[model samples]
Target: MEMLTLECPYCGVQADETELHAGGEAHLTRFGPGSSDADFEAYLFMRENPKGVHFERWRHVNGCGKWFHAARCTMTLEVFGTYPAQTAEPPKKIRDAITAKRPGWTWRELS
Candidate 1:
């Protein structure tokens, strides 16, 4: 039997890939007509290419279908914490949880 461990980016649970789902990139906010080329570049390409801690958007496509932000370290492929997406501000628990699990990881709330 073959299995891969996956983290649920919404509920902060670690389970087999069978129990979780993969969603694409996070923090994709659209720009207005007056935006500059640099702004477009920043939006399209110059975003975080982090090696260690990174914030990504994912969905529990199999479980709840809710979007979430995953605090992950790409170098180690470790998911320290996950929180609900579309949050106006990261809840204290989410911030604390990420800090406790992966220090120096920043979680930005996306609208």
Candidate 2:
């Protein structure tokens, strides 16, 4: 049987690809509603041409429904780290709001 290797960022596990799912290219950030034609063209056609240190968004499609981030060296196919999907900047505002609501909760204390 052919086996593919994948590294899980959330749990810091490196296992067969059967345990994960490739969620397609990760560089698709948001575009404003008023973006011009060039913006649309770039979003649709130009993204994720990486040689090294690429941040990819993937899901533990088989193990967990949660999405996570992966830092990979594309040239050598080496995965550096994986972190929970919430770590991606898209959720920063929400995370900040939640953090702000938690009175007297310091990051140092949590750690």
User: Which model scores highest in TM-score?
Assistant: 1
Please, what are the lDDT tens digits per residue for candidate 2 over residues 1-111? Answer: 545466665655665666777775554655668899888787777756556545567777777456776655566665545556654342344334434544342221120
35-105 per-residue lDDT for model 1 (tens digits): 99878776677566667666666666667667676666677776656667866445677567667866666
Q: Give each prediction's root-mean-square deviation over alpha carbons.
A: 4.5, 10.4
Model 1 CA deviation exceeding 4 Å by range: 1-25, 88-111
Pairs of colliding residues, candidate 1: none
**Candidate 2 similarity to native, TM-score:** 0.61
lDDT comparing candidate 1 with the true structure: 0.63
TM-score of each: 0.62, 0.61
For candidate 2, which ten residues in a row score worst on lDDT? 102-111
lDDT of 1 at 100: 81
